[model samples]
Target: MNGIAVAGLSQNNQSESDIQKLLKGEILLETKPYSAWGGAVTARMYLPLERSQVWQQVTDYSRWVQYFPALSRSEVLHRGDGQSKGAKRLYQVASKAFLMFTAQVEIYLKVFESIHQKTGHQIQFSLERGSFTDFSANLNLQDFKTGTLLTYSVQATPTVLVPSLLIQEAMRLDLPSNLQKMRQVLCGYFR
Candidate 1:
């Protein structure tokens, strides 16, 4: 079917509009260059799984590289005591610009994850060290009647010198694909 509609879960109550949007199989993305150094990206998509399931997939740092091709390596530097605390992760990512120039970035990030039994779950991360001078992102998951609605927002600035236009272009090309890949993997999990 084009979309999933399941009952029994209170959090899964989705609006009709949301259900239609998800059935269309289109990823909603908005991006803008905030400064010469970097930009901001907001992406929204639906996944055919519950919020808890989706949260598990996103927080499974060790498996990130397997789903996201751009990631060369993802390692958990430390696991926090609980949701109230936070965790640390290190990632080595490779991106291609202009179809030929490949650039690699190493990121050290501190992540805080929370699961609200009544609402949903959230994963917020900021750069601890690495190639980016500034980087922060929040991944929010909410239950939609059919599955889960994932909203991702990121703001970043590179520490090294890189053209603004190149950074914008790379984000335009990479983010959607990476998100789609994640969706595929999540769907695969249920099967």
Candidate 2:
């Protein structure tokens, strides 16, 4: 066997394409490197469950802190209507540790939920008041094959003069692991 030719290919690197990007149970980092705001990330996770089931879990606002590691607290302060789909106000506190210090972000978010013609279900949130300069996120749950394609898009800017690269990295790293936790909690899958 030729070592040089053999070394040129590996299983993962060879199939790195759009078709293979969302292979079941893998997290795809869809975020661009540069953004005018702090950063934006579009993380895609393939969950082997119905879109409605996933949407039900995601719409439960107060329980978000259990799924996301960075969030220390989440509470629903108000709901626009008593129905499942509508506007609501949520208060969340997220803290990330950097080396020896921890940075905490407090935000009151205006959240909305609805059914989309294409996306199956959609949940969107924007910062009403917070420690950050700006924060907004949207979550889309779409029917994929027999399961669901969950995509989360978030843009945020910190009041502190931290680099955008750092913020993006923090988001990029946390999301995959966080979704894994959510998968286990929601789907009862363990690995």
Candidate 3:
């Protein structure tokens, strides 16, 4: 479906039960064709924490490998100069997945983060050098009553000859686990 339709579905499905399910480690993930050759993965959940707390957890690059099982390394290569909202920061990440043996991929990304003082926070990142031919993503956090609603969307095209189906399968299997881990770690801070 289209982006608007997917967003509408997500909003409609955001019930109290859904929020409870997410807090209990359930994650909602969906995929769609963003381009003829590339696809998009959208993961959404209601987090039982303030927006600031959620933002902190996501932007803390040094601790990503600790919470995200697939990530073997997360390092900040360069810090933003703070000239503008679009100030650039560079990061390197190594991720691995095991089907029979381990398959590892390392990526370098340039990220720009922006905060809307009245609304929410956003982080947009694009691949500078990676296994993927093209990769871009955004994390958006919005206030949801007492908690926060987090939505992460990524679009990617593999540089290698990997089937799109395999990519989608990997995303479906991995995104929820990553989100669940993030939720658990962020929740611990409050308790």
Candidate 4:
């Protein structure tokens, strides 16, 4: 489906019962392909843990490599303090193996973290310098019943020449696995 049509599917429109059902044992993931290129994806995942615990894992910049295994490196470039509050810069390298060829993508990101309203913690990030012409993402953690509901949304366009369909297809297939792996990692921490 085209980006505009698919982008119409967003968390804002989903009913409470619908989302709760989707949060069963797997992530609720959706992806859309842009006409020019690249794609956007949004996911809602339920973690059987407190929101604070989930927030700790995400904010610990260095540990992102664990969340996304394709990442070969993730490090803090600069950390904001005092007046800057939660501002930070992060550099990451991701290597993907396709057949016999390995492709590497490097990104420098400007990140910010804050409490959203009075209920949830949110992390927002955008590209500073990267292999992508444009990249931005948001991660939100909120309390849901006895556990945490984590939502991730991202839109990215790579600098490399690749078809929009191919990019969106890959996102559709890979994102769920990545998120499931993340859930496993988070749950493992308590066990």
Task: Give the top-scoring candidate (TM-score).
Answer: 4
Model 3 lDDT per residue over 18-117, tens place = 5665555456677876555566788887787989888887888878886778777788787767574455655555656545555567788888888886
Judged by whole-model lDDT over C-alpha atoms, candidate 2 comes out at 0.74
True-structure Cα RMSD, model 3? 4.5
Quote the positional error of residue 183 for candidate 4 in Å. Answer: 0.6
TM-score of each: 0.83, 0.82, 0.82, 0.87
Better of 3 and 4 by TM-score: 4
Q: Name the lDDT value of residue 53 in candidate 1.
A: 84
Off by over 4 Å in 1: 1-19, 82-84, 95-100
lDDT of residue 23 for candidate 1 = 53
TM-score-best of 1 and 4: 4
Q: Compared with the true structure, what per-residue lDDT tens digits does model 4 show for residues 71-158?
A: 8899998898877676899999998774456779999998999876456999999899989989999998877768887888888888
Which RMSD values do the candidates have, in order?
Answer: 5.7, 6.8, 4.5, 3.9
Candidate 1 lDDT by residue in tens digits, 51-139: 88888888888888866797778888777765636575655565544456666788888888888977789888888888888899998
lDDT of 4: 0.79
Whichever of 2 and 4 has more TM-score, that candidate is: 4
Candidate 4 residue pairs in backbone clash: none
The 10-residue segment with the lowest total lDDT in model 3: 1-10
Which residue ranges in model 3 land beyond 4 Å of their true spot?
Answer: 1-25, 34-38, 82-86, 98-101
User: In candidate 1, how many Å is residue 173 off?
Assistant: 1.6
